[model samples]
Target chain A: MPEHAILREVGLRDGIQMAARFLPTERKREWALRLKEAGLREIELTSFVPAKVVPQFADADALAAALPELSGVTASALVPNLKGAERALAAGFTHVNYVLSISEAHSRSNVRRSTDEAIAEFERIVALKRTQDGRGLVLGVGLATSFGCTLQGHVDPDRVFEVAAKVAEGGADELIVADTVGYGNPAQVKTLLPTILAIAGERRVVCHFHDTRGLGLANVAAALDAGVRAFDSSLAGLGGCPFAPGATGNINTEDAAFMLDSMGFATGIDIPALLALRRDVEGWLGDERYSGAIARAGLPKTYATAPRTAAAPALAS
Target chain B: MPEHAILREVGLRDGIQMAARFLPTERKREWALRLKEAGLREIELTSFVPAKVVPQFADADALAAALPELSGVTASALVPNLKGAERALAAGFTHVNYVLSISEAHSRSNVRRSTDEAIAEFERIVALKRTQDGRGLVLGVGLATSFGCTLQGHVDPDRVFEVAAKVAEGGADELIVADTVGYGNPAQVKTLLPTILAIAGERRVVCHFHDTRGLGLANVAAALDAGVRAFDSSLAGLGGCPFAPGATGNINTEDAAFMLDSMGFATGIDIPALLALRRDVEGWLGDERYSGAIARAGLPKTYATAPRTAAAPALAS
Candidate 1:
């Protein structure tokens, strides 16, 4: 049996945030169902934020309501703060990822709060998750700009370690170290991940990499070597950090999954199905830029996509 | 001092081969100089093929003669057989890489000969290289389609080991495992490279990967992990395999350099200069499809391109 590696799709939330036109709620739902069918066992479907901030993820509640239809799929939404997490819990979300940028400037610019304030909010959310109504909610925190921040220039690894220590101790179930600016190199990932993982201790360490400088997949490969088993990816490499101008696409979901699958890691992703979804999404999100290689070149002739019925996402080699 | 890793520019040969319009000889000289000025110590300037076959390389002699101007740069060209190599030797090339496909079908389609015939030709070239004039020449065998092929699909690992053993014993000075069809995965690279390296023993093993399926740099990272110190890259990712339909770009020279630079590898590549070269090459080759990330995203604010004055390209960490 191959070792499991979870690649959760963030196209609906992270990817679509960049799309100019608002995709109808039905379209987002359709895409979500297609992603689930395409063997994406875990999908981050929406972000709970005001429509004024990001109109694309305005359908967060609506998408959250459709989670029941996505049986067998581990669905998640991104929540900005205590209020957002509370809303997600009220909307019946089983999982919500709270995002906090490690960079002081990025944190203020992105969520209109300081890094310490966000940390306080995260603690509040964790406390909220312990309440009667939030009993079943899984709270995950994404440390945005963990690798480096455009606003702050080089983000110190000590800062990342400091944040991870705080978040892990705050009772977070999982921590996602993000290369929000796409400034991360494989060496940085290799050097920093061990420390971040060490700080997280028993908590799961997931990585979110942007393909900004084209090292996204490479960083993922390094993280895999560092014992990380889960990743956050956007479809067709959609989504860019608005904070980092000229930065485009998250580490592409299809590309990341294809890479993992080809590496003999059990991703349980149907690449053909995922590519088909990419084509549809491209048509749907007409103006948004897409970045990836497999869709353009197509899968190699030797590829055998793992069946979705695989018990877990794991490594074969 | 960081350990040395060489990133040889193949954009002039591998990249421009895909260009529809012929670039002037002067333009080629200018780009080659620019590449060297950007601190790429090695550059695969052209291929020694008959002009009747690839008119793009018709000026091979002119470019080879111009090599004298590229002082301090280790330039090479591709030779199909002993005759082309003799032409290169006569033309003053100190290095020539011989092309051979691991896939039998690809070998026939690409070089118009059986794999064994090509091997025989390779042996003939090695014999010729050992003589008085060829003494100074460095011989490298690029086993194309070693990963997977568009024509024959998966090229067996045992077959790769066999070819490496034969080439190493047959007097080749260097071995390049090329993912010609862009079918290589990191797992496959990490798996195959150890054996290939073992077979090579004292001889160096370089990697030439096509970004056909987007895992180029990831594979580079894997090869680096397996102890490969040199790689072949194209400016702006300008090349593609003729046999692989829809394939675009060898790994982008600038992207690969940037990746290595970020990983703290001593590539001695001036990425800002490389990006400037990419812009010029992009303008020169108007229609050739380009693939890469850093060029589009620009280098991060924290990036400090290696000083061209550096003595070697090696790992710093």
Candidate 2:
């Protein structure tokens, strides 16, 4: 088992993109800085998508330029296509995440491309990264709808691994398997994550689950049992599934961090600080549905006065 | 691994007791019959508390009488003391559940008894059941705050198992471990449930978790992995923690059943009927903070036409 787990903050990117209101660039930067202060080492700063499509991310370049203020935090951005990758690279982001749907039907509906076309785009993105003159840019591939899809349900594990193999072969720095529509359960996670990990190898695999059906943390538990140590979560659980409106959003970062810390996984996260940010997000995104339990009930008294480290260290193994 | 899992619906007793308005007797009876139609074999009908104290269950006798209408469902009632036990048995309920808090503080505050006194009450309840000439009633012993307590903080696992042993020795028909305040995590469930099952044996141990901190289904997964096949849940995720206002309530029956069924655990539930009932509850408890994600998102299309059986028998082993 790994000594420390990595939680990549995706609120600024994935979360704000789905919001009903436009979050100012300054608030986005503030959210990032607070995340850094809360001990988030990796932060998905923003997405380099067309401003007309996702106006919330129009400040993507501005957020990327402000990353220098968040010292010690490794900043990353989402790139939807070759054009987005160009923008991300121009913004000087060292880490770029490119997503492709594992289900062919979802791929066509979501990214407006077939699975093969997406894979070919990934190859082009990798080639673009390789040709960057003096920049050491790394590209991460996220397999969306890896569990099941809203457009085409029951995505095959073999299909997910097939895309995973292509991502690995395409010289990607990270391989993330996402239950984009929250259609996954723990059984699928335990059964499929290990195979995905085998292809991605150590320190390269990530799990992203939405809480659309209230199994986000359960899926996270299964992935952890399958030896996954990295996950993507949104602050205040900001991003509700587009497919399942009025349902829960992405897995809440504070809640997931608290669970991991309670279970003796060293998350290096300041849960109290994250909880404080949850309150701020609630204020920032007024009337936007914010879901998570720890923010309401508070932490167990056992965690009080304890060091900000994994509690029950012996249990981690 | 068991061929089928049992989900005891506690919506009537536990869920309605916490609601803002009193649910009428007919509504309670309709809820039970609906639960039976949804394939629940066991339902906690109502508590045998004083009508003046909890007016919601003032219809305990009326509900018990209506249980005959639910042909295939086992009707159970909550009995807090020897007085409640007498009432339950007099009402001809075959299954009676008596709760004793494992946390001394919670026991003193909630039930107005010390832990030792609660155990003594359990002994008395068992004695009462044994003395029933030909009633053949079964007594279920529930250890509330078995994981942790809001007032007492960390309830020791050793202390919980000690009470489990006492319940087992007292000749109770069932042993239920409940996280009353939802302070438990997956690691705690995985660690404690096996010890609980060791004392109670198969088909005798039950896990009751609240989604207070959004770890309800995660804890369910851990308990399932630990070989627990019986769980207690409420419809539409009704019932908040009396101790923690605004906290999540009991684990949602539909969500837990869906996860277990998707994971190849034979839950034998009619999910669509449950989902429909959830909408009714949402309307029934107007502005009462109803929850559970599956009711909004609906089940995956993969499970759309599949029979209400375990999807994979091999993985369960």
Candidate 3:
């Protein structure tokens, strides 16, 4: 396993998508800027879906256009199909995540397409990324419900491997295995992560987890032990599984960072800054429920970054 | 790692100790009985503390005497010193957890004794457990703040090992490493658990963690990976560090059972029964803050406990 891990803040994209009220374009831009300021090197800023269906992300183009100003940060956007990919490319987004529900039932309900159709769409998105001029866009194929599905119950691991093998053969830059409804357990992660990594190769896989069953961080630990170096988390734990009844939000970004950093994995995140942003986001979305423990408990006193060493005095007292 | 793990439900003792409203002695006994109904073989029923400081457990004697009626259940109580231990013996309790804060500052604040003094008391208690006639009692020395301390900040691991060695040599039946203030991370557990276990022996070490920072279950995962088989958890994620500001509560018992059972570890727990008890506890402790995601999300659809195999049919449809 790598000594470092990358935690991609996906609150703006996944979190806002499931929210009850829409945050304005200006607030979304503010959130993006604050995320960058909080030392997030990579962030999924928005998704290019139908503005009518996901009105909250109607400002995806604007957010994508504003990414150039934040030169050091890698801005990512979720694209559902070839049309979404084109818009992402037009807006100059260098990273696009094309998500597909591995379960056929979830695929039809979520995207109005079958699993094969979604895979075909992913191939087209990858093709679009290749054809773009002077653009270094990276296309990642995300396997949603890769662990299990709420609608279909237990998804066969063989089917997940089949989809993963196809995505790998399709020439995507990255492969994402997501427990969309948080049906994964640590044992499953311990067993399946190695297989996923074996097919995707090193540095090609990202693990996305939800706190629906409170096993999000445990699954993260399992993936870490399995040598995964990148993960997806949301600030303030903002998003929940729309299909999984009474599910909580995504893995909390600050909590994940705290766990990783404390475990000696260098994540390059300023946790206090993320906590500050979490506070701001909490204020902005005032009645909406947000979940994360670190925000409530604060960091441990033994937290390494909190200026533990005292300054040397010129003369003894 | 052991194929079977024991999750000792400590909510009645630790959780109710911190609550604003006091559960009557009858409710406490009812909670204990329900814990057994939920398939928890071991439970910390109450604490033998002064009623002036902790009125919630004022009926410890009554609970202890009543525990004999709950067949197949190993009832335990928290005893602070020799006096409490004597009371526990008089009440005919067979298991006692003698807690001592490993951090000097925490030890002074919690029990008004220094670390060495507390260790000396533990030695006395062990001697008492050994000297008693016809009392087949088991004594566990719980080293609270073995991970980190809210008052003293970073606790040295060397101190923890020293305490473990002393308790092991003092003839205690078990050694408990407690993250009293929830400052522990997985790396610490990975490094410290083996050392503690080596000193205490396999199945002789118990892990006590708080979800104050949300790593409670993650820490449990770490401990499980380190070959430790016993854990301490609460009913509705109740109980917080009285000394640690903003700390949430203990690891939820239902959450722990779900994770362990799903991971193929036989905890001998009926998760649905625990959830039902959790609901009852929630109703009793109305308006109090409790945490646990499984209660909200319900069990996974792929959960196997409910008659997974289909009965043979005469014909197919």
Candidate 4:
């Protein structure tokens, strides 16, 4: 059987970033705590960006204040630049995730920098994390547009490998491969993930995929079959890119958890609890175009009885 | 590398069966032909059932009359009993699909028969297929709720295997394992599909899966990796079970074909033409809540340059 997978909740950071309105600081804290209580060991609680640029994380400091109350949770926040990394450390986040796009056009349009410039920023953030105040901070790197880009179309695997090797050599504590524009497929995920893992050596890796083309869960399955054990998902499938108009966002946390648990990976998620939280979150973020399947179909009748293990015959081969 | 997979369009039959309103006969014929024009070789054109029961396929005869004009296309019709199969053969359908639920509860509620009775009915149908009028007809059997059932929940694999063995031995030309309510996951699929193939021996097999829990394409990927080809999909992911409310239907025909093509399988689907037809179909089926990723995100940037094949390492192993 495959190992237990970590499903890090990103609804607060990624999902909220695309929402039309900002959730209150306290509500964000409460929701994060609820997610942790519902068996998430890690949570990407918020992002450190200029409030004027993205108003959703305007109260990042206030939201990060209650991280200590999360008990055994490993909380991380997104930092767009070195200054944002500084803000993240100052706000009591011991882990920070820095994102960089691989596609030149996506880098220019999304982060207002070229791909090379984004890599340089990542190196700078690594240096900043080595400073006194940033000591003990685990700096993870996210490779946006690692799979495909809306602006650049198909991203070459050779180029992606080059960037991944750079991140792996640049001292990222973990590597995150993201399908930033939801243009990924199962064949790509199964083929590319092992190469990314080989580049990372011993560093842990996670994938961030979108449901823009409805292949999110299928890609997750491919990754698992490829030996991936960690994933990033949002509650209620709550996130979308500002650039990809009419596109949906990440795979649902509850739905992915259900898939993971059903596949016998031991995600330790409480389906009923997660579904209840999803309902509350839906009410909180009224009319935000929520997505998920288990929330809609209810849990499978055999959910508790027969969680099939991967130790079954070599069926995929 | 994996071989080319067959994608059989089920929108006209399964999709319309679930629609609140019946599609006009000429429009149904036009849509099926348009589907064929977009490179679809097989289509479940319609179902042979009483108009008083379904109302959507009430014009089954009218729709079947145009099958000859399809030229080289292979057309199949769904049948609930031997009588329906007889109707299908009389109406120029060279292929007929017989559906049976493994879940006794589902069988009772769906077709008003027990599981044993359903198997017995399959035997009777096989006898009828050997008769003079049905001599050259191909009798395909669909194992409904083979994965799980909304009524019974978590269908037993042993029971499904027994039914599959009987069907294969009783002369089923094709075996279609169906996730009637979408309670299937990738692991369950990868494990079960190979066993189904083992029971099938030399017979061809297809899968009819719903996206109720968003794992439709994932199941497809698993089945592909398991060496099974041919799937039943509906346009824009249409079709649903009345038993499972809030459940969406099959994987999108265009999206599944796109994934198959991108995965280096020569499905021969013309994405642009299919998308155009989908737009027209969407306009025809207003308020129907269509589902698919390719429709919203469009095609990828690398669609023309690169299509990844399965030979790229043992990623899924």
Q: How much lDDT does each candidate structure score? A: 0.86, 0.84, 0.85, 0.85
lDDT of 2 by residue, B1-317 (tens): 63677788998878878788887787777778888777788888999989887888888987787867976667889999999999898887878999999999999988799999999988888889889848788888899999888888888889998999988887788888999988889988988988899988633888899888889999999999998888899998888767766677899999998888888767768898888887777777677767788887777777754555333222110
Q: Tell me the lDDT of candidate 4.
A: 0.85
Worst 10 residues of 2 chain A by lDDT: A308-317
Off by over 4 Å in 1: A312-317, B133-135, B312-317
Question: How many Å off is the CA of A99 in candidate 4?
Answer: 0.9
Q: Candidate 3 lDDT, tens digit per residue, B1-317?
A: 32677888899988878788888777778888877776787888889999888988788988876676677777888999999998988887888999988899999999999999998998888788788746777888899998889899878889899988988888788888999988888878998999999998643788999999999998999999998888999988999777987887889998998898888777778888888887888888776678989989999888877531121111100
On TM-score, the leading prediction is: 1
DockQ of 3: 0.54
Specify the poorest-scoring 10-residue window by lDDT in model 4 chain A: A308-317
Q: What is the C-alpha RMSD of each candidate to the true structure, in Å?
A: 2.2, 3.0, 5.5, 4.5
Best by DockQ: 1
Residues forming the 10-long window of minimal summed lDDT in candidate 3 chain B: B308-317
How should the candidates be ordered by DockQ, best one leading? 1, 2, 4, 3
Q: Write the per-residue lDDT of candidate 4 for residues B253-309, one digit (tens) a residue.
A: 988988888788877567787889989888787778588888887877678633222
Q: Which is superior by TM-score, 1 or 2? A: 1
